[model samples]
Target: MYAQCPDCLTVFSMDAETLAQARGHVVCGHCETEFDALASLSSQLPPEPFQQLPEHKSSGRPPQVESAVYRPRQESALAADSGTTPAAESEDFSHLVFSPRFARPAHQNRMRRWPWVLACLVLLLLLCAQLAWAKRDALVVDPTAGTLLRQACNSLGCRLPLVQDVQHLRLLARDVQAHPSVPGALLISATVRNDADFDQPWPVVVVTLSDVDGKHVAMRRLRPSEYLGDGFALQRGLPSGTSTALVLEVEDPGNKAVAFEFSFE
Candidate 1:
């Protein structure tokens, strides 16, 4: 078998029968180069059992060639004979014969994408939860509820137009009579201004009533016309000599109601 020196690129031949014996240290005839012939022919050679050669005694005659150095041209010629180029021969590659040590696992490849999918799912759920929470108090009114709301608004002192429908309403009532000389009644009203603005129809109103003794006397709903035009009318059936303070409140589907407050006397 023929081998090429990697460092000096010298070519040499070894006896086929003695190839295994001619391994590690061998003398090259052409360039008179010494090389690790076994390593140089690794691709074209197979492994052999470790064996030590008997030491050679020096010859009496002076050496014909003083230095045996391999050359690049000789290396190329040897590579061509071996059906390979010198560049191809010296490449540090073991992949042709052995697999890589660290190959990626199939599960690891799939797991790399999971975090993004999980995040998207979590974001979608959060969006749905937020939407539900935002609409939690959305009111769905029927004709009956609309009528009741209208009637309640009319019973208070606030004056408002006839309400068509109510979509949402929030009412807050409080009693504060500490400011005595002020009117004993508190009124609130709301209404829709135009048909184009009917999408959000319901309006909320708050009313507070208080008396000179820091007490609330009477509270009731008033009609839009009554509230806007004048103070709400007192309901009948009170004792003739008794005095009662009143507060009025009203909410109109349309924002056309007027809110006001005054003492019944």
Candidate 2:
């Protein structure tokens, strides 16, 4: 009763008798192409010749009546009489034959999957970045980590962490001596050590030279650029559990320099 055009995919309804008379050949009204109607036929059975349905408006006149009559061959008749139908119509759908228009294109499916795969990769990278940010403080101290970060920061234009808790810097020794080369000038010497388990940035050392009465006579604040000499190798900061000697020559205040206080800022 129902058949489709293989080329244009247009559906039309006709009686079994009419289909049999036409031998499955019909003209499509939509595309005006003559093709074998049975090639695109659906599974719906034809209505009995005597069955009459209500009439409705149509786009075109009904198909012309055909002159010839179609009949089953002897073997087909024998199989039908034996209550067995042909397996072609009832075969496994997975192995069913498909026309060109009905089959899905493999490349289209592959193209559609790429965006989701790319999105998943982006999310994975973002997760890794969040994790790295969470552990930045701990990673900065590792010598190997510092090297890697420096290389990455150089290209990406990012700044490295350069300061830590100044309380970790301990004053090991301190002494002041007269500068032999320059009169009225005092040479200050101090030993500072890092006590933390990891490396940290150099802190500003504030030295206050005081008199016997404990009154501050001269004060000086040393910055990182002033303290880190050319001999220092570790670019990031000072290594943990290590000591560095600080030497400074400055003018002696008029009052006696009996005591000194060192504070790391």
Candidate 3:
């Protein structure tokens, strides 16, 4: 019988004695790949012109023109052959348990993720900026938030609008008297104190005049510049934990105006 080397297609003559040596496990004398020699046993070689056989139709080995037992490994070398596969031959593997797909290097994988990381950081910053702007009126009065907002605005060359903390302002004293020199005029005076730890924008002082029956007769809103007069005091705002006196002059609302009440806004 003849057996073909599935790897190199070099055929070797085989007999029962030689085939049973390693239970049909034989190494090709030419290519040295081990295979089941009995699987490819044939009675005779193919006729004449050597043509490459389609690997899928036959075996995976490329076709060879002629087939013959390698003279040295079979005839002269058989007696010297040990007939057992050596331990080092394990490196010539024909089967694998699993195959791995292509993978990028560690740094390359990290590089590809950097853009997404940067985009997330930028989105977080935008969210914080939007929150600061939307709650500017509230945040600007917060000591911590105010400092952060001021630093950010200063860096961006932005002008922050002044905001009042009316709840923290106390109307310490008030007086509504007829103007001494101005006829039919009322001179309104009040002491406003800021109860907060921080300086706040000047509050609008609201004065309500009512009659004996407690019916509202007139009302007035006094701004800082109008009542304080001094540009320095108006610009500096109400100082923290301090009192400032303000005065307002307006035409009296006739006999109906008897009592007055004051509030800060």
- What is the lDDT, from 0 to 100, of the residue 46 in candidate 3? 75
Instruction: Evaluate model 1: give its lDDT.
Output: 0.42
lDDT by residue (192-239, candidate 3, tens digit) is 788875568887778889999999999988776677777876776777
State in Å the error of residue 106, model 2.
12
Error of 2 at 2 (Å): 14
Query: Which ten contiguous residues of candidate 2 have the minimum total lDDT?
Result: 50-59
Regions of candidate 3 where Cα sits further than 4 Å from its true position: 1-102, 141-161, 223-225, 228-236, 254-256
RMSD of each: 22.8, 15.0, 16.8
TM-score for all models, in order of appearance: 0.20, 0.50, 0.52
Question: Per-residue lDDT for 1-265 in model 1, tens only?
Answer: 4466654565555443445455457766666777666554532333444233222345788668868554335777887799976764564432333223234457876788799999999999999868744543331123454445446656985422322333222222334222334343223322223221112322222242445554554444444334433323222222212232333333222222222232221
Q: On residues 173-260, what C-alpha lDDT tens digit does candidate 2 reach at each position?
A: 9888888899998888889898875667877878798888888888988886776675454366776789988887778776577888
Task: Say which candidate scores most in TM-score.
Answer: 3
User: Per-model C-alpha lDDT, please?
Assistant: 0.42, 0.72, 0.75
